[model samples]
Target: MEWIKLIGILIILVGFIFKFDTIAVVIIAAFTTALVSGISITEFFTLLGEAFVKNRIVTIFLLTLPMIGISERFGLRQQAVILIEKMKGLTTGRFITLYALIRQLAGLFGIRLSAQPQFVRPIVNPMAQAAANARYGKISEADEEIIKAKSAANENFANFFAQNTFAASAGVLLISGTLTSLGYEVQATSIVLVALIIAGISFVLIAIDNFLFDLKMDRKYGKKSSKGGQKS
Candidate 1:
């Protein structure tokens, strides 16, 4: 019966596999685990409350979403498009590459951002589309989708690789603590240095990818525009 406590893991796995409501599944798993472990319902709620209180800071970031929504209602995306239009010579790929660099810098400084909602969807995607329009006149829906995907990818890659570059970042602290618990002497500073190096490498690789994408877009769109003009 003691092994029944492990049934919570099975419940969670099955729930996720079957696409159950995520919060309900997690709570059900926790309740079952507590019950099988001989913990009373009152005690379980007490533990849950304690854990929530201790980690409540994690939810603070969600507050920014409402503000972002309000801004979008006030023409935030349109303003981004207007701004991008005036920036001559800034191509879609180049703008996305620049955003990646900015995101990396923000991560290295421990500044948290909700990339997809706060920047990518509202700012980056529109600006990228505008830049493409400026250069190639108008782009296909497929190319717009490509810009959105690449913008989100840039944010993900920069944030994931560069966040640990901050000495006090969650990743650095978690790594150092785990290594120390495993009897290894690991310093957060050391992890930060390694993360910075990885960030630099990722930035270079992403830049190269953007350059290639620019070349592909040029071949597909730029030459077509020129040829159409010549025939006119």
Candidate 2:
């Protein structure tokens, strides 16, 4: 029975090697592990239900796939390019930094709009790329990939660090509950206060990183622009 537990790991390895659907493979592997550990099938369903309730927002995010597809099919990226081209003062770096600021502020207020794939990838990334293209003409494939990564990173840093600043946030509640269970007697207020300070520091650091990365891109573009001028 004990050795049978390893079968779940083997299943995952095989599934990955064969390039199977990752979500299906992982869920099946989890169920197999629970059953091998002597958990009843009914208990497994109960666990799944509880997890779904706790993270139903993520489920909703997944459901937005069709909506994203429809929007993109209707020239979502083209609209972003047009809008970004009209904004003279908004460079790629400034745009990402501004988004980070808004994301952190929204998280503090419990609004939580820092979704990368849904919001960033579809909308924000295209706009940032447009801004870069406006300034640099046409960038290399590698530079565009790096800019997208930086945009995603800014979203992640803002969302993760700022959400904890809310006293009644799920993260604070979970932390308080865990500490209570461990007999630590931690207060939610304390967690929120510390989280607030951390959020401030994170915003500053990420802003700096965005600024520096933008400078690097600027230098690259500057070189390209000078070379083009010399050729003309």
- Candidate number of the best TM-score: 1
TM-scores, one per candidate: 0.78, 0.75
- Model 1, 1-232: lDDT tens digits are 6888999999999999999999999999999999999999999999999999999999887887998899999999899999998887888889999999999999988998878888898889899999888777767999888988998998899888988889998888999999999999999999998998999999999999999999888878773243334111
Best by lDDT: 1
Pairs of residues clashing in candidate 2: none
lDDT of each: 0.89, 0.85
Total clashes for model 1: 0
Give candidate 2 regions above 4 Å deviation: 1-58, 223-232
- Candidate 1 regions exceeding 4 Å error are 1-18, 32-40, 173-191, 223-232
